[model samples]
Target: MTVRSLYLAPVTAVFPAPARTGQGGAAVYEQQRNRTSDADDSAARADRVVELLGARDEVELALKASLGGLPRERDETLARMAEVLQATAQGLALDAAAVWADMPERVLRNWLAKDPAFAAALRSAEALAGAHGLAAGPATTPTPAMVRVAVLALSRGATWPQAVAVAGFPVRGFRRLSQTHPVLAALVEAARRARPRKPKNFVPAGYRPRRPGQAPPGPRAFRLVRREDQVLP
Candidate 1:
């Protein structure tokens, strides 16, 4: 029986690390240049794909808007918008609204104006997001803690929408909750008038004449409380 030992050159020795001169250097340079070209090509392709996808999304949104392709009922739309606005973080409601509803901020704003519940939800969300430094955005699933915070905010002069911003609950859902807990609705309603608003058109209360440069005595001129003679529920 014969014993044999096989020896193999190490990769470093066989390939002999490229020197910074002549053929070795030229080969290394060519390899690097090819890699750079390939990378540039890949990057360009990726950018083109991204651009195309973005354009497709824009086109789809435009078509949907023009065709009134919203899938939910009007009330449902409002509720969903409220939920997204409430749950989303600050500085992101506009983007969130678009993503959630496939509608532009301008269109959503128009709806918000016409829908008190939606407006309230948005305002509440903004309030909560600002207060908690949660301006980045909403969680995927709203926690019970978030709901509790929203409820507390509502009780503390925050509107339903504003309070529920972090709750991820819909406006209608909050309304239903309010029904079971009347205090919630009452508190929100009361908070609405907690601060007096200036008279419209700069007209003073009791139709009194105002002098030029007068700021209509500010909001303090009028009391927010109802009169004693007014009937109570």
Candidate 2:
């Protein structure tokens, strides 16, 4: 047989183009879809496995452990911190709690940073104390000394942190105090709003309104110059 006849002798020859709109075409499309879905599922499963094996939780737990002996449940410690913070909000001097529970300020700060619930309790206590005017000492009476100092500092153009320091209150504690002592806060705000007064002599000397003796401007005469009288090159 000739080369052309030999090449054509095979009955099962491959086609140059792909099949379309038939069972073979449908099968190819379904296979492609199945492969895409399988790839997505595998990627998701891999991510889940990585997350399960991650050490992020372990690292946080280790850090918390290094902060010394915080209460295991957090409730008791939170209660104690709340008591102190509540007093602060009621105008009890924040410095009065310097030796809170015989724990140093650094230790208390560490606890505040590590535990979210403890921080939240502190906020709640401050709010409650502000609303109720609960004092820090056993007397539970609000004091004017500390708030007055803070107001004075703020009125003198001190930053909030500086004012807080002058008043010997924690930053959040001072905010709570402001809530309880709205009058002091308002005074501080007013003082801050007090800008340098515009001088009585804003306008130059001899200007109208500022210089009442200055004569009103005279009306100008509108005499039109004739084209012949105009002096132009």
lDDT (CA) per prediction: 0.49, 0.49
Tens-digit per-residue lDDT, 64-183, candidate 1: 466564422443454447546744544344544443433445767677677776677677777777787655444544443444445434433445676566345567776776677544
Model 2 lDDT tens row, 1-233: 00011122221232222456688877776676665555444444433332332333354446656766542444334444764565456544444332223234565667778777767766776566667766344332335545544544454346788766645567777677667764545544543443223347366666646376778553332312223432211
- The lDDT, on a scale of 0 to 1, for candidate 1 is 0.49
Worst 10 residues of 2 by lDDT: 1-10
Candidate 2 CA-lDDT value: 0.49
* lDDT of model 2 at position 205: 69
Q: How many residue pairs clash in each candidate?
A: 10, 0
lDDT score at residue 200, model 1, on the 0-100 scale: 72
What are the models' TM-scores? 0.30, 0.24
Candidate 2 residue pairs in clash (backbone atoms < 3 Å): none
RMSD of each: 23.9, 33.9
> Candidate 1: deviation at residue 129, Å?
3.4
